[model samples]
Target: MMEFTHTASFNGHCTTLPLSSNNVTLDPTVKDKWGRPALRTTFMNHPDDIATMKFFMERSMELMDAAGAIKKVGSYAENGQTGGVHLLGTCRMGNDPATSVVDRYNRSHDVPNLFMVDGGSMVTSGRGQPTMTIMALAFRAADHLIQAARRGEV
Candidate 1:
């Protein structure tokens, strides 16, 4: 990333956003759940959340400089979503088999007994530290696979 270009080496770091109950900045003018309105998403990083990354990189560099430490900061040129990019996509939950490549279980809608998990199942990236959620999804998929195995879907 542009942030890492000027400083110290990375030591295997990763991050996820802190989702607060009041963080939603935009709403679809809809309401639900408790006789009130609701937002489809309360808060989100932009499609390309470069600003957030840039801010973090700046702060990191500032801190390192303040502490008299060497630092190199830059963004990864490839793209921003590398952390969560590998998970979901065409194989996620869908209303119809024709729409999604995978079923709710993330199984290949086209192939029997084959399932995928992780970022590969995501339709959109979350402004999250998705690993925990990704793990949960993987567990759920594994469970579904096991059940399917019991049912002899494999």
Candidate 2:
């Protein structure tokens, strides 16, 4: 399946570069502000991704042929992989001692007791919309942070 990793720095710098190996090529040939070959994206799908695509095409063809399709044609994934599900980058937030810049209450990691106090600190949002989860994390973190302060964990 197509998968990618993303990282965001403490300074709010984030990037989402593709990591898949699928042949789903895209010629992003253009010049950038710095006079660089902007980018030419060509993803070669992972093995599982190709397999999944093949299965889908095969099944589709069989079904169509069974239904007496006269023009039964098929093609498989050349990149050889399943496919990537849309799992975004930087969807992580927590109070981990390291790696994460935000605490459970969404506070900056390096700063002492200073909080980002924003929605970007959330770590995961499961399946539902992230808005609701971020709000919930904020509420929970606020209460817990207050309690921690009372207990001297900060």
Candidate 3:
């Protein structure tokens, strides 16, 4: 009997550009029970994302073959891969209000007092482990908010 293990790398930079792609719109025809317009998403994977996944899958198969596997069956493509636990980039952070929802400090551009300290503030999806980064960002935002409050800057 031969042992087989399957694993995947969780590293892909497939976010929409700040000014383009993945445009979200309020569906005027579709409404919830509360009579509020539902959000419609237009998301597509970047070409680079597909390429990277293909490369990783090929490498993994090569490794498996080297390990004396008699039969190997693996595919990164031809099968849907919804491989993300941490959804990111809903509200991106940037310096400009025209492109970003939040600023560098995770503060809303429209509302100075409103701070968004979460994964939504991330501009990129990051490499799989986003919890730690989110926590750090939260701490950083908290510290900044506290200092701003102390200085009467809201």
Candidate 4:
């Protein structure tokens, strides 16, 4: 005789607010083999993010119970998330150069003819995947670049 069993899992994601402390900066002491400064990343989830995670975890537990799960186990980060899958909001896009790295069109405020059309330019990560948003931004930046070139701006 043969037996079969099944298992399921769920994951929840929430948007995190922008914090001045969470950033990526050039390491003053560390350098790569090419002598360029290594990138240093610092991140910590906000209290609201932790609370949202807890809420989702509780909901998932209830769902499992309603599904008549024979056995269940669940856990969430009580303190905060140590790391994340999406790397976003590194080079924030805004109108002011003092507070942001890129402009509305993803062009570097300090560097001419340079564009940053990646997740780094995002001010915050969305609840869902960012691939489509990133692609849209890239397309928009490309079109802007094309128009600028036509006008001899690039």
Candidate 5:
């Protein structure tokens, strides 16, 4: 007698549209222990995002059927995303201070000495992992900072 086991899984990711309403703000009524306003996050999935999640679920089911799986189970948020997995696109990067938080080099537009080289500086979340991209941005920002320091710009 012989025994064998096989398993497969599929995970799909979708790019979310940016909305001004989805943002982090300081809570006017809530204060932290340090006397600063507490951070309040407002987020809701767009209609397109919900549709994309449904599409991915359907595709995953099809793939499972095509693989002749004996049993399969899949689920997605029917209403909207309840929680976030990858936290990206918080501090958007752009050339204009009026529209974005960070500049092209990941430097804070409002604060000259502050640099944001993490996922928060991304303008949009990619459909894949952002680790490598964040690393690259950090390296680039570091290089720019070094050059700026050399020029006595800091």
Candidate 6:
């Protein structure tokens, strides 16, 4: 029998305030083969992320020690994990237009019926994983949008 496990920690919550750091913009001078503007991504791992990974590494090593591991080999220090597989918070949802791209219900503040239900609507990343939360939000957004449409509120 074989068992596999990973020792990693992730926080979707960035230390930098929303609408302050990280962004995606189209390169005005560049275009795709289809004549569409190319996207320019700008992101850097925050210090808090490094700290969190280090903390998790320490805890993992302690667990290994308790498990009576004779040889421990891994480095979560110096070079911590960078970025994330679960991209989020691109179009943050908020009450203030200046700070967010979508409203609380995942509806675009600028477009009445425009709804953005995805990881992008998250204002902050949760700890480690966000797929479940993203799915739940999608359901909630759909329900709200359906109700709004029925009531002619959209």
Local distance difference test values of all predictions, in order:
0.57, 0.52, 0.72, 0.86, 0.86, 0.72
Please identify model 3 stretches exceeding 4 Å from their true place.
1-19, 78-80
Count of residue pairs whose backbone atoms collide, per candidate:
34, 21, 0, 0, 0, 2
Q: What's the CA error at residue 121 for candidate 1, in Å?
A: 0.6
Candidate 4 lDDT tens digits, 20-68: 8888899999999999999998788889888988999999999999999
Q: What are the per-residue Cα lDDT tens digits for candidate 2 across 53-112?
A: 566677777777666665555666454433433333232355575656666677667775
The window of 10 residues in a row where model 4 has the poorest summed lDDT is 1-10
For 1-154, candidate 5 gives per-residue lDDT tens digits of 3224577778777767778888999999999999999999988888988889999999999989988988787988878887767788879999999999998789999999999889998746757678899998899999999999999998
For candidate 3, the per-residue lDDT at 85 reads 62
**Model 3 lDDT per residue over 77-136, tens place:** 424346546677778889999988899889999999899888887756544567898898
Per-residue C-alpha lDDT of model 6 across residues 1-154, encoded as one tens digit per residue: 4233544333223233344557888889899889999988776656776686667667778878887766676565335345446677778888999878998788999898899888888746655467888888888889899999999997
In order of appearance, the predictions have TM-scores of 0.44, 0.36, 0.81, 0.88, 0.89, 0.78
Candidate 1 TM-score over all chains jointly: 0.44
Q: Candidate 1, residues 95-114: lDDT per residue as tens digits?
A: 57775667777778778767
Task: Give candidate 5's TM-score.
Answer: 0.89
Q: Is candidate 2 or candidate 3 better by TM-score?
A: 3
Please list the residue runs of candidate 1 whose C-alpha ends up more than 4 Å from where it truly belongs after superposition.
1-90
Clashing pairs in 3: none
Which residue runs does candidate 5 get wrong by more than 4 Å? 1-6
Question: Which numbered prediction scores highest in TM-score against the true structure?
Answer: 5
| Candidate 2, poorest ten consecutive residues by summed lDDT | 7-16
Candidate with more favorable, higher lDDT: 1 or 6: 6
